[model samples]
Structure formats: C-alpha cells, structure tokens
Target: MSSKARHSLDPLNLDRFNHEALIPLVSPLTGKNYIGWCNHIELLLTATVKLDFITGKCERPTERAKAEQWDLVDSMVRSLILGSVSKEIAQHFIHAKTAKSLWEEIKGRYGSHGPLLYRIHRKLRSIRQGNADLFEYYSKLCNLWSELHYLKPIPVCKCKCNVGKEISVGECNGCILAKQIADDKSETELFQFLMGLNDCYDNVRDLILLMEPLPTPSKAYSMLLGVETMRELSKGEKGCEKTHDLVCSYCKKIGHTHEGCFKLHPKTKRSM
Candidate 1:
C-alpha cells in the first residue's frame, strides 16, 4: 500500500476520515481483525450523525438545515430543567424554534414577581450538559413552584369568637384549623370544603340574626355540628379566639396575620 493508503488504513485516523471514505477503507479488514478494532466505528458514526441531527447540525433536511444548532441545544437544556411531566410538555420544548421563544414561554407562565423568575433564569443559564441531571431536577422544581403559586389557600369561616357574627365572606381561626387538618386532601376536596362552609355560614347567619340573643358555641363544637346543623342554627355563633394571632385584619382570614395578607386589595383597594 502507498503511504496515503497505509495512513488511511490506520484505526487511529478514523477521526480524520470523511464519511464517504470510511466504508471503502474498512472493506479490506474483515473477520476478527476488523471486528475487534473497527466493528464499533460504523455504529459510532451513526450515533454522531444522529446527535448532529438532533442538535440541528446535520447538513440534510433542507427546511431545518438553516436552523441554528444552539437554539435546539438551549431548548433541550430548558426542557430538562423545567421537567416535562407529560408528552405535551416535552413537545413544547422539542418543537420550539428558538431559545428566545422557549424563554418567553417560561417567563409568561412562571414570572409574576420579577425576582423569583430572574433567579430561576440565572440558575438555568449556569447549567451545562455535564450537569444535565441537576438541570432536570431543577426543571421539576420549577414546575412544582409554579403549581404551588396558583394553589388557592383553603377558605375558612369569617366570624369572630368575641363578636359571634358571621359575614358573607370571612375567614376565621376554625376555618384555618380545618384547612390544616385537610392539608392532605386533594385540591378538589379542599375547594368543596370551602364552598360548603360558605353556603352553610350564609344560611345560618340569616336564621341566627332573627333570633333574640345570639347563641355561642366553641369552634370545635361548631365544626362537628356538620354543615346541615350549622346552616340551620337559629341563634348561635362560634368563636375562634384561640387563633387570634393567626387572624388577618385586612382580609379577615386566619392562618395569616394582617402583615401576611397577599391580596392586592388587602383592606381598601391598596396593595399589601
């Protein structure tokens, strides 16, 4: 063989060889000799081509040929970081045409206050392929954070233990305690509990006001009386003085003090 042919025949030169020349060069070596040294070379080349395609570096596929590989890389990174629990979520990342679009979706979905979203963006920007698993874990956390953000707090009664009066929309200590006890319940169950309490309170408030002296009942006793009795009480009010510290003067809700009210119109159409 000539020097060029000898050099081409060398296994170490595989990296420098072009795809067109690789098949022909390997045609001579066969049996154990080729199998031991260059059997995996074809497979390796195939994998490299696939990776290039996935990363948008492939020369073929004319429509997507002009697309930037970095954009695809960014989308991959974002997808892994922002955990896709379903095929739909995974498709979002896979179909994204640019890093900017993917980033915009993330911001629109998760960014309300600037700080939290910015912090997440910064963290994602710092991660690379070497730490891919960490990136994936962070993505799941982001999804969880987004889910928790929209989660409504469990509604509680709006009556003061001392006043023994119920309002149309109120949150009291008993309501808060009940919510805590129902913490393990599903969101649907929690919602039902809140709606049931609201309806029951409205019914009892009208009946109790018609009676002479307002009836007084302990928080625990009132809760145990069930929705029906609480709805029909002619003259009784429950007190939640035990959770005085948890009461919010602004929204009149328990489990959060006035300072902790998250409502935009906390007391009088003013941001809290």
Candidate 2:
C-alpha cells in the first residue's frame, strides 16, 4: 500500500496531528465534517489539560472560549498603556511647544555673556522706544559696549570754532568736516588745520572731497604731500618744524601749540 493509504489508517499519527496538519489528511472529507472534528478535538484537549491542572473538573468549552477572548482584550489594553507611557517619556525631553521657553532653557545651560546680554538689552530698549529698526542701533551699541568692556578710552579732539568747543570723543570727523565747509576759510588753511587734527588720513581725504567747492588738484596734491611729510617728521624725536611753527604763531595756547590744545584755553593776561 502507498504511504498516504497507510497513514490514513494509522490512528497514532492522526492522534498527534494538529489542526493545521490535519487539514491535508482530511481534505477528502466534507468541509462540515472536518470543521466538526477540529472543534471536537480542540475542546477535548483543552478540557483534559484543565482537568489535570485542577481537581479533575474540566472547564466547559464555553468558559474556555470566554477566557481566551478576555486574554486577547487584556493584551491589547496593556500594549496601548505602554505606548502612551513611552510617548509621555519622550515628550519630557523634546518639547514641541513654544520657542521662548526653549531659548531660556538653552541660555540657562550655557551662561549668558556680556555681549549677548548687551545685545538683548539694546533690542529691548529699541522695542520700548518704538524703533522697529534694531539693526541700525545694534552696531553702535556693540561698538560702545566692546570699548567699555576693553577699558579702551576714546580721546576727544577739540575744534577751534565756538560751536565745536564742547567736543566729545569720536567727534573728530564731524569737526574737521564742519571747519572745511565754512566759506570764511581758505582751502589751504582748512586743509592744514585738518591735518593738525587727530582724525585719520582717510577721514581727512573724504572730508576734503566732500567740500562744497571741491579743492583743486594742486591743493589736494599739496595737502597730500603736507600730511605725508608731517606723518614722517612726527615719527622722530623732533616734530615737523613747519607745522610746529605755524601752530605756535597762530594758536592761542602758550606752553604747547594749537595741535595739542584741547580748546583755546582762556587767553592769559600778562602780569607786570
């Protein structure tokens, strides 16, 4: 006989068969009969296991079905609870909420420095003043804040004019420009006076170019040569004689010269 024929009659293999494996063997049987057999086998095995575990009083098939259904429902509930707890733990570290709180947290972690605090203060001040353009004020504030931090004091350059008497540090450019524009002065005198000021060479050149009646090429060339020569002469122990002589004769100051004068110190009366 064939192996299939032998197995069909073999009760040992059929008794050990599970529902999945029994399907192939029972394929020749009607679907209703196969399903009845599966249900009967499952109920008998479940009852026998339960009876062994308990006092030989097996649980009914209806009770076993209810218990299995309840177990699936309990597992689903447990999975949902664990998923919620994991989400909550993740949210504790990664906040998807407002940026303000996050920024504060970062600032707290890394100590806020002077420059950063000054920038924030300036921004707040600009907001309070209703000046929406914060960038315009930022550069000025930063420059001043840095100077203050470094303890580098700015020098005040005095102007001969009455209006420029109350000069403050960082006002040299404007003072020279103003002196150059007034129609009363000659171009040569203005150029020479500007050279005497502590303003940078570029600033002097720019101011000269911006004058109402722009200086002639000859005047510009002369001014350039004069500034270069003065720069060279001032480097050594002795100062430029031409520049020193002009300042000494014309400048109101006695001990020093106009180039060194903060302002026209009050003219001293001669004592008899």
Candidate 3:
C-alpha cells in the first residue's frame, strides 16, 4: 500500500492544521522582490504535499465523490498560499482556479527577467565588509553566490573517461562546460571577496595574490580568518592587560581606581 493509503485511512484533520504557524510573512512582490517570497511559498506547499494534499496542476478526480474532496483540499492549499501574500500580490492570482495555477501565475509574473539579475549583480559588486563581522561578510557573499548559482545551475560531467585519473583523456561537453563556468565564477568571487577586505588585510591579500598559484576562495577565506582571529586574540590580551594595570584605592580592584570606585563613596553622586 502507498503511504497516502495509510494517511487516508488514519486521516488527520486538515482543518485543525494551523497553516499560519510556520508560514512566514512574504512581503508583496513588486516584481523585483520575489525570490524570498517564492522560497516561503515553496516550503508551505511542500508541507501540504507531505500531508497528501495536491497543489500542482488541476487534475480530474477519477471518482465523483473524490472530486468534492479534491476541491476542498485545493481550496485549503490555495488559501494557505494566498494568505501569506499581500492583497496586491494576491489580486493578480485571484482568478486562478487551482493552487497550481495560482503558483504558476505568480512565478510567471515575477520569477523571470533581466532586472532581477542586474540588481543581484549590482548588489554583489557593491558589497563591502567594512566594520562588519568576517564570517557574516563571507556568508553574505556565499548567499549571493547561491542565488546566482540557482539562476545558472552548475553543469555535471557525463563522459565515461578515466574516472580515477587527474586528467580525463576525453573531457566531454559537460565536463568542459562545468569547468569553464566554475573557473570564471571562482575568479570573479575571489576578486569580490578581496575587494571587500579592510585596509588592515591589504598586505596579506597582496601576498595571497603574489603566490606561485593563487589560492582558492575558501583558502583565501582561511588565511583572512587566521589574521582576523589573531587580531581579535591580540585585542583581548591588550584588554586583559589594561584591566590588570588598573588599581582602585578603595578595594584595590583591577578594573577601577579611587575616583571611579563605587565602594569608596557608596552614597556620593561621584560613586560609579
């Protein structure tokens, strides 16, 4: 028996399922801002699918009795999809008869186009790690790289060449295409990452570039991280030294002197 067969026999109440519990508030897509909205809708739809609810193309039910059940589940799924969206975004798909139609309608209206790609690249080009956490900076770049990757999926190797050898004697279209695209992307991302680093990392960055074979982005990140970690450790050590150097005349504490000691004058206005 299928999993759906068991699910149908011991049916949970779909009506009792709180659709709003996990669904995020998807901001209305003004054509430009829809990727995140689409992601939210996809997750919600996947949840419904797991519950044996169909959200795809409107298919006719084999039995007359099942038609009614289909319509009810379809409506529920559609409502879940539309509820998270704004009125403006919802209005465009108001006429869609099925959940699938509604989903496709929204994707067709906002998912494609050059403007979105242009904006993504523009943001990538302008990103800077100034006064920001290094991990956060790397993560932001990685997210943008992921978004770009989704736009253009990585090609896979299909040729049956020497599988274990370093050089494939017969590199097919898939392998060549994948390698070319990966090389270009890696170079571009490395340059972007290097550009975003602060002046403090200039010497280290230059050294990486001057190497016999320049390091990969991941390697560059490791080198930068090592520098950042050491810098933070040095700063912490200096802070500890400063703390130890302090001497309060009241209780002789390491953090404060007599003028800043709260114990020296507990009731005085100058007490800290």
**Evaluated with TM-score, which candidate comes out highest?**
3
lDDT against the true structure, each candidate: 0.38, 0.37, 0.65
Query: What would the per-residue lDDT of candidate 2 be over residues 1-272, giving only the tens digit for each residue?
Result: 99976755432222332433323332221221222232333343343221111122322235775656534433332232222223433244244222223223333433235554565445434432123222333334444334333332233345444344533323468565544443233453344433433333344456466766877534654654564455556555233333433222244322344544445434342221
Give RMSD (Å) of candidate 1 vs. truth. Answer: 25.8
* TM-score-superior candidate, 2 or 3: 3
- Residues 34-151, model 3: lDDT tens digits: 7766666666555544234434444647887777777776777677777767777778778788777777787777778576678789989899987677788898888777777767
lDDT for each residue of candidate 1 in 32-134, tens digit (9 for 90 to 100): 1222212233343443332332233433324553334434434443343233223444354555554345434543554444554455445444433232332
- Compared with the true structure, model 3 gives a TM-score of 0.65
Candidates ranked by lDDT, best first? Answer: 3, 1, 2
What is the full ranking by TM-score, best candidate first?
3, 1, 2
lDDT of 1: 0.38
Model 3 misplaced regions, further than 4 Å: 1-18, 25-32, 47-58, 157-171, 211-216, 237-272
Backbone clash total for model 1 is 5
